[model samples]
Target chain A: MFEKKRLHPISIISHIAKQLIDTLFPLLVLVVMKARTVSLGWNIAVPTVVLLYTTLIGFFTWLRFTYQLNERELCIEQGVFLRKKRSIPFERIQGISISAGFFQRLVGVVQVRIETAGNELGKAEAILTAVTKKEAEQIARQIRKVKEGVVHDETIELINRSEQPNDIVFSLRFRDVFLLSVTSGGVFGVLAAIAAFISQLDDFISYDALYRKVQALGFVRNTLSGVVAIFVLFVVAYAISVGRHLLRYAFFTVRKQEDMIVISRGLFEKQLLTVSRKRVQGIIIKENVVQRLLGYVSVHIIHAGGSLDGGESGSVVFCPFMKKERAASVIAACLPEYHIHHEFQALPQRARVRYMLRPVYVFAIPIGMVAYVLRPWGMGLLLLLPIVSYLGYKSYQMAGWAISANQLALRSGMFRIQTIYMLKYRIQSVATSATWLQKRKQLSTLAVAVMPKMFSKVTDVDEKEAEAVYTWMQ
Target chain B: MAQLSKRISERAVSVWRIYALIRFTIFLLVYIIVCFLLMKFDGPKWVVFLLAVLFLADLFLFVLLWPRWRWQRWRYDVREQEIEIEHGVWIIKRTLIPMSRVQHVDLKQGPLLKKYKLASITIFTAATVHEIPALDEQEAEKLRHVISAFVKVDDRDV
Candidate 1:
């Protein structure tokens, strides 16, 4: 067993900040409402009391919380009054992640999260809110050593482990990072959200006044100039998106050490995740329309236990941007268990009719209503037919499945293409479904349940091929 | 390929019919309340007639026909290596959950199922859950034990 240790004193302030962050928005709204109605003294007094209460609570929380790491398990005892104690065995821990924010880095302490394999979402089994970077590394190394059954000579291994060299399997290049930010769909997503938010403001918030203000600002004069203004808005959104990606993945690097993949990244604040290799369930290679046109793709790993916080959206991004061909090499060098290929078995030609008819049937009623309402202008609805046909064609072209021995790879998408590579062991279930029409055409949809609910589906595949996948999974 | 041999209890049809009837009763209550408000507001009286016709049609289609059709389609085969479940009214779906992937199995009974002396067995994998609904109580218990043995043979978790 080890001595009980408390988090850094800095966590007292951090805990207060974390608590405030949860209510900061509502607290601000309340303060503004009070500021308009109540006296200035009361407004200041209210915030002061809230801060004092939070600080006092943070102090006691930090004081009460203590953790101890032994050779067998990690034990945590924390509570203001209840005095709850929880212990997690080393064998049960799925992985460990370490991250340091701006403030934590300044104070040389990192937040340590011990992840346990379970069905829970956004939860870490044990979180040591604040520990020195050296301590965090020692804990991680000790856990890894114990998990590997190397606790026999802990002191020497602990020292030599710090000297353990990690093979740099992959990293983002300077130019590649710029290219990634440029082609990232995140910018468009932000722009669409901003557009939606602004459009909603017309109902009550008087967007007319805002439009007039923009007119006054001389950004909009005629329709052509309005186009320029919209273009400027897009540029700003792109810059913001790029800045965010740069901050988050500037020094991104993936390294292989023992049975763990260490992914470290960030510019201002560093984050490192040590994922157990066996804990990774699958891999996904993704490409948006823009990235696909440019022949670039990103690789992400589907992991089981890590929290969604501070990590890549429930799955870790192994490669932010790389050529499709280069991604194969990286997977070969780093994770040979999964395989990726651009070529997949094509769907039968008869199935093409089904894909083409889908968009037409789905949009027919809506387009008819629009055409009816618009009358003369409604003739433009015919133009949508070609676009939808192209979509259907793209879906047919992109959706396919290929099995490489023990691994199954599925490429499928509508607008954004995603190719999921899953080992036979990672697939929870295999399904083959066919409607009457598809059955007549000897076509069935093949789908598999994978982690993170990334169910990969190859629609309108040859039924025999679907049966092959089902048998392979069995 | 061959079709799955095992079939669920025929009592499943009656169980499903009762379940559908409960839902239809709730739908009727809501529809009647809506028509009452429409009458108060002097809304189109035709909607009242239209909804009544639709309600009766739904009672015939769902409460009467759907349960029988669904029960007939429900079939499952649990072999030594895997379990194949086939169901779905229009789009026939066949799923294979390998025995090595099964995480656990459970036998459950609600008040209505208990009244009918029926139980359901749910087989859980790491990512998906499959339920064979409305089996005889003893049959469900046996099926659960069988699947539990298979799941226990494989000690790995996803």
Candidate 2:
């Protein structure tokens, strides 16, 4: 048992930094508003008052926050003015993720976030923002021992032996990191983020000057220079993606403790991710066209509730990048229960025609309307029909479901192919739908619902096969 | 596999018809007020005529035709392992909820349902919910108890 203790003193600085960031926009707006009307002294006074007030509050917040761990619960007493206290039981703690921002790294401390099952919108049950790395590890070990019902003597011994060797399952190498960025489609994300940033400044900054600069370079008239500019932009985007990946996942390592898997990674901001083996719902093997061509795949674990990515739906990635064979070996080493035989039952040949027709019908209405409106020249747009239909056909080829006794595997998607393996017990419900035309064709769409609203559907399967799967779900 | 496609109570037709009639009346009132405003603003006569025609078509379809179609389409069955529901007129959807996944069962009755001596059963799972509408009150209670029992046993096993 650990006695009540205050957070590391560096937390005061972190707290102040957080407050400054929070008030940055409002302070900027206020300064802009008062610049001409108010005196220079008054302007400076207003900002100083705001900063001093926030700093005082942050100081009190840091002073008040204290935490303790006992046999049953981890109790946190916090809140500056209101004095709120939360007691979270060891059994209720589903996961604990440790993160260290730039300031925390400089100060040699990490932030520990504890999560329970029913937490909504990514809010942790308790967050210890500043704790030493050794203390954080000790707390995690204690929680794990309690969760697994291990005796205190064994746990105390394990904690006492600081040199205990943990089995290292996998480590992301330099080549793996390079392959991840090149194959990840993260360049598009960087481009989109940069575009969004520029768009936000659209009202303040003028793009006409940049456009005129390019125009003055004679690049507009010479098509070769235009192509060169595009190449330059692509290289810039790729470089940004590589830099971002390196910052986030540098020196990534996966280690196996007695009953849990711990992943530690990051360069600028260190992150420690811990997941219990029993809580994983399934594993997903995913690869995009680029990754497939380059012979690489990524692995992610499907766990219910609480997200690691804050806002977006979270998946626990065991390997950010690996060879297809290595991914299978990692899965076998980490989640042996899920590494079962998967016999896939593919979609029927007749269903391929309907899959091909589906997109054609969807595109026909808009394309036909356009062609009808612009009688002669717009007819050229119909050439896109073949391309769309081919994509749909590819989707049909990719979509499949396999059911053995205990496990159900679904393989689907066209552009980014994903093969998900889940135990039958993890499925909440199964549904099949058919339009009147589909009924006549003896085809139906199968939808299987899993926890946290991850619904997998295989379209254009034989109605009888869908029924068989439905019956097997029992 | 046993096929159990049981329809809801026949009185549900009258209940749906009453609901549709109420909706139609409200829509008609709103339509009349809008038409008055349009005429006052010197809107085109043909636009008013088109609106009137569309309102009439809606009235004919929803008030007169849809209740019967809905009653005919809605069917549900409870098996030992799963609950099967077949619904929708145009799309024709079939949903199968595994008994092990059901978290709780709720028996619900509104003023209209009470008036018709009917109730609906709502089954909740982790991901989503399913409902069987317009069952006889006693039947709804029995179904609720049966489902809750299954959910309890499933919870014990887990």
Candidate 3:
């Protein structure tokens, strides 16, 4: 039922590097401790044993690693002394996904992932490390053909399979990518700086000393320096993000493979991700306040079983920028089943009032108490009340929910408009509740639970409307 | 097996009432011990008395409302495609789980329930938990068997 193939030779280096990175921190700690103790005998023996263990494991991994693909199954054989084999039946295989980092891209190879049903986390059932783009496509096509019994004639074909006339699918230009990179939150930049500083602690002064030095720079000098530093950080972060995005999405192309949609992109570390027509929960067309004003929207597919790694923390955005109309057309063409009407219905005024008032009352008591206790400082701090109130109101106004024939859609967030959809069958359970005030106002809050793709639950809906929808669903 | 349509046995209320009472009693005893220890350490006499009074009041309320708290009110309608559960006091919650999504169902009994020859049935969905507590052992076993058969049938159909 399953066949085996050999992994690319380059995977040996990648696997070793991965193993080294995993054990580096603990090994460093042990070395530092040995140095402080000044016991050369123990230090030498400890490091020697550690190196031997690491080398032995690395060598065994390289020796044991093997991959195979046949008509019915794909099998991966890998383990140290204890040999283990994993076989994924062709029929159960869901999709093939590819991703490559800068180093892999430099070597002109991409990592291929073969996803299967049931398992949510962990590596794809099988991975082909450092495969050429053509080879990856051939593997993906063969797997799909065996699984679905459909043969795609051309490697890349654009089909006009719609009642409406076809239009050109828009791809991100270099300028749009730059704009998105600049506007992205620079949290990754700050974290990278902190990591670098920590790693060089032995060679440099302590973080506290650095902080004191910055503080001693006086008010005007500190402010000017802070502004200059922030500006420089933003420029660097923007450039890196833009460069990465360009490298990853340079030759982006979308095409149909039978009933599935396949998107392949990237200049160096190319990726080919395919989504079955039925598996796409919904197409979310989003635009932040800035992007909305600029008439651009980002397109993302809401998949039921798979999520971007890092628990939605990383901005591994798909289609970073696109015109709203073009994005809609692409979604319609790609996934005809999930083509929802664009008309959005705002919540009732009473519901909006309840939503805005609840957040205020919840925060007001504690905030007011804190402000009163700190009144000796000044009454000016109380000015934050109006700002908080404004943000709450904006959030209430932005929150909306809509139900189409087969899809339930919810839009939320203040600065960034996030739209999510859940098909009827995928929903596991729905529960509704009403606080005393809500009950008096004839309103209820509802929460629908779905299987979490990564770590957290993906339940999104307006509280009151969700209750109504729950009742309606039942 | 006659298709079981209703909830667990009528004796469920009595069992839940006893459980609540035992829990409340334990809570009261713990509260008293903590307050007594605090007073021994010369803590605020007034605060300790107030807390003790609150605990006593809570115990009384729990005993008085035991009937309402222990009442087992559930409505289940298993159609060809889905199973719906409506239960809860004060706040009524209704959940509809499709037959396709039901992973498994189990009928379990603890030491207390074993004495009474009763069992609790749990329906496992993909994400949420639903329990039908206090069924006669035979009834529990029958429901579990029936649900398992239905789940397997639906899986094949899909």
Candidate 4:
């Protein structure tokens, strides 16, 4: 089904309009905020031109795009001016996923993405922006049938057969999302973003005047009030972070249907992604300092193709938050082949002195220069030295590695602990290195690469242990 | 120190020396341009003096010292099971890639290498690429064939 046919004409409006809104929304806000300074003619001129340009792009993009699917491969020819051709054989296809955004939902259509065992880092092989749900499902089914070497009997009402019931494997609750985001660095991230945004907003409005106005209100006067104001600010940031996390992971679910693990989440964007079980490289259970203290961890799936935009990282977050004790069972329920181990062989004692001294040596020159420049004012920054030492100590404490059967679990972190669990068969390569000092100290840094260009390393391990790992990998 | 069985061609030293010289000359040219600009603007003479000192130090450190150290450090071994590579002047890194995981092998030749009758063999596993740089052309060709032959027909989709 393809070359002569096109997606629903509404795709032009729904898909392109969403992109235009995302890109132009901030610009539009800026124009309106500065409308008084700029002439009415200029304000109207900017939006009018933007509107006309987007319309032309949308129309041409839709007019030029077409896909053709045959027994051998799926071919797509698109681009308004520069004709681009892409073909994917059925064997290379990993899976197909359907998602819907607000616009697509309004038009009762879904956006379909085709994923392959692609060499490209972070992109889907093909995307059908707007297609009927039935057609999308049929295409997915047909591709699967072809890959499985199942002969298609088109004479029968076979495509209409209901799919295997999905077994729900893992899910995230609102309470967990709230707790996860509150304790996460995300609160600080949001607060920093807001602070930076307000700082930049001076271009449109003056916050200095607003600050004086607030001072007149006596909002932040004495130390007690200042403390309370800071507290209030933190509470607001935490609230926003939780709200964002909740919306992003609302009704988050993972279900297995045959060989595919399907993940669906998001309140507005409604992302549904499928990962072929065969293509899963490994899983990493990550816990930051706060999460470790609270006994919570997040699990991420490392897939081969890495085409699915799982989250901020290439690995997809399987469960945003789970009890540290419960993580193994939760992961087992979904992917039983991997055994997540908690016990680890800690770094050698000699490594501790090296770890602790590293940060000091790195930050010494910079801190000294700053202190020299700022004198008494910057000398206060020296207080951070103790904390830096403690961080290095913590990194030494956290670093560990273990091997069981044919699987390797490597744990390393300064502030956030990540335990990468990969089977021996899945490991792409292993590299061990040591500086002259490290070699003298009998310590080596071992890096294990599971996905293309993604490496998890444990530095300052016993050279013997590193050698053992190499032997194990061999 | 652990020693790998093989070393790159001796010509690699001259190649790196030539590269370092070329790079140093560019830096010298840029410094000349900057001095001209500074003179045009009647800028500080101390600035040019400071830069000249830095450039001389750079010549000593990079153009003279680095190539020999790099050539001395680089080594590799192709075994039946895995290909091991060790390189780096200060922090020597040894990477081991099992034959089963190798995706492909490439023998690449650029203008400088061609001029010297040398080539580099790049071995790509699923995750990273390791290059044994500036080998004899025939040695690189042999390595390309050996690695390709050793690479299993079915990689575990790595």
Query: What are the runs in model 4 whose C-alpha is more than 4 Å off?
Result: A32-36, A39-56, A80-83, A149-166, A184-188, A195-241, A310-314, A357-382, B154-158
Q: Which parts of model 2 have CA positions greater than 4 angstroms off?
A: A1-9, A12-91, A132-166, A186-195, A198-240, A308-314, A339-343, A353-389, B17-37, B43-46, B152-158
> Candidate 2 lDDT (Cα, whole model)?
0.77
* Candidate number with the higher lDDT (2 or 4): 4
Per-model chain B TM-scores are 0.94, 0.91, 0.76, 0.92
TM-score of each: 0.84, 0.78, 0.70, 0.87
lDDT-based ranking, best first?
1, 4, 2, 3
Q: What TM-score quantifies how close candidate 1 is to the native fold?
A: 0.84
Query: Tens digit of lDDT per residue, candidate 3, span A347-457?
Result: 556666655665677667777786775464425556666766776677667666667885666666655666666666666666555544555665554556554331111
Tell me the spans in candidate 3 whose CA falls farther than 4 Å from its real position. Answer: A1-6, A15-87, A99-110, A121-123, A131-170, A184-251, A308-318, A358-385, A422-430, A448-468, A471-474, B1-74, B88-92, B98-158
- In order, the first chain's TM-score in every candidate is 0.77, 0.73, 0.69, 0.82
Tens digit of per-residue lDDT, candidate 1, span A1-474:
499999999899888988888767456656775566688887788778888989999999999999998988889999997999999988887666667777687787888777776636557788888898778767877777778842212322322343334578888887888888777854346678457534543344446875786677753244356568677767766676777787878878887766767777778767766665767888889888888888999988887765534455347788989998899999878788776676688888888888888888888888878777655556688788778878888889888888887888998887678888888877889999998888888999998997655577889999998998888876
**A194-232: candidate 4 lDDT, tens digit per residue:** 565445455775668757865777543433564585577
Which model scores highest in DockQ?
1
Residue A240 shift from truth in candidate 2, angstroms: 4.1
Candidates, DockQ: 0.71, 0.58, 0.34, 0.70
Q: List, in the given order, the native-contact fraction of each candidate.
A: 0.79, 0.75, 0.46, 0.82
**TM-score, candidate number 3:** 0.70
Ten residues in sequence with the least summed lDDT for candidate 4 chain A = A151-160
